[model samples]
Target: MDAERGGGEAPAAPRDGEGRFRRRAFLVGGGLGVLGLGGAALVAGPGGVRSAYTRVVCGSTPEPPPGGTAGRRQGTLEGRRVIVAMPRAARDTVPVVVMLPEPPGDARAPYDLYAVDRYLAASPGGFAIASVDGWPSADIVGALLPHLEAGGLDVRRIGLLGWAAGGAEALRLAAQLGSGVVRAVAATSPDVTAARAPLRELVDIPVWLGCGERDDRAPQTETMLKGLKALGATTEGGISSGCQDTAYRRRVLPEQLAFFARHL
Candidate 1:
């Protein structure tokens, strides 16, 4: 099956090395703090650690509510459960952001974990959000794009967003689909090591890679950023002061959305 045609079997779930890293980072940093080892002092003592940590862990701003104007649709595609969120006052044909959830998370993860619907409502431009169950294969997204277009989305302008393992999948799919098909890609706490595509393939595509400063994957994310730059790929995002947790993702999501809005 050709990935470009979106007619291939889904790949097995990629191994999750980041899960171990998330656990370790939590235990070592948040755990020590919880154990009365000056966690409060570190957070309250303030040398900007508190501010940065709070921003990363507890987002500096409040997430918006999904206004009545927004619409949500759910169904199955290629045997995978799918969920799509359409922004407020969306046009008959809107661009879309394909969300690839972390391994073990289903189509609902984007909303349940990130409140993506609310973010979409708050975005300056209108776009739809499409998420699928399990690890996303190029075939799954490849099928998804046209499906969305059939449902009134602008398939020509597309973006991919994912977290952790899903992040890697997003990168792989973007490369496989080629720059002509994908406009931009954004990832949080991605396991780039798991992505099988060559960075050179991403030369013309705009990419955004972000992770928590305290996340164990930070170094790898930085390395990926440098590599993308070396390839002259337009890239954004770097280490922020938080660990590999939900808070960090929420804090970074707006920027990711903005990046997509600019390019897509």
Candidate 2:
């Protein structure tokens, strides 16, 4: 489970915070006993993924896409029933984050936010933090298309933050959404070469890609700069510091939030 990128001679887990993050990333949610609340799903078309995103686990249970578990509605993606959590608080045109989890059965769950939230727990400039679940990274965002618009969200300020599956999901949406999503951040995200043909579509928006040097799953640090370059995106790529684990050096998530705040 929390191995090095590319699955080579991975190093041992450090006793520092990063090590804890990796361990948490892979198995946090697995240990939890989740209670199904009859989720609400919104299905979309046939989506694609390059290399899958890193699998990290959070202690969160699967719920509907609106960000809460109270009243569940039914949605579909590719005709598959989808469930989303209803947003907890009342928001008027709130900036939202669309997150996709790694494959459900994959070693890594979609809990990358457990680590991301540690750094970005509070919203910047009163921006409310919200994430929607999808069949994959792409499916989670399908709800945002029109099915869930009544939430009164400000689409102009929507920022996408995806880990492995979610990153690809966000990228897919970026290819289609045009300027709908103001800013994007991909953490240990896949490259365009592995994405669909639309990967070349230009975003012209501010995007950031981050990966650990040891995270071989995708471009550890520099691949995103190259990929976004082709897409004509105003983009930057770099390694994240402050990671306690040497195998998967971490990019400071706060920097990611700063990028979102600055651009979105």
Write one digit per residue (lDDT tens) for candidate 2, span 152-252.
Answer: 45656666656565566566666677665545544444433443424355456677676654445444336556666766767765654222221232234
- Tens digit of lDDT per residue, candidate 1, span 1-264? 455577776666546886665464455456446544435535444444445455545455445554633468988876877788998787567888898878875888888777888887788767788987765444565576777778888878789888998888888888888788789988888876624445888888899999887788888888888988987889999888777777778878888888988998
Q: Count the backbone clashes (under 3 Å) in each candidate.
A: 1, 28
Question: Which consecutive 10 residues in model 1 have the weakest lDDT in total?
Answer: 41-50
Computed on alpha carbons, the lDDT of every model, listed in order, comes to 0.76, 0.46
Which candidate comes out best when scored by lDDT?
A: 1
Candidate 2: lDDT over CA atoms?
0.46
Give candidate 2 regions above 4 Å deviation.
Answer: 1-92, 105-118, 123-125, 137-142, 145-148, 185-187, 191-199, 218-221, 230-232, 240-251
**Which parts of model 1 are misplaced by more than 4 Å?**
1-69, 194-197
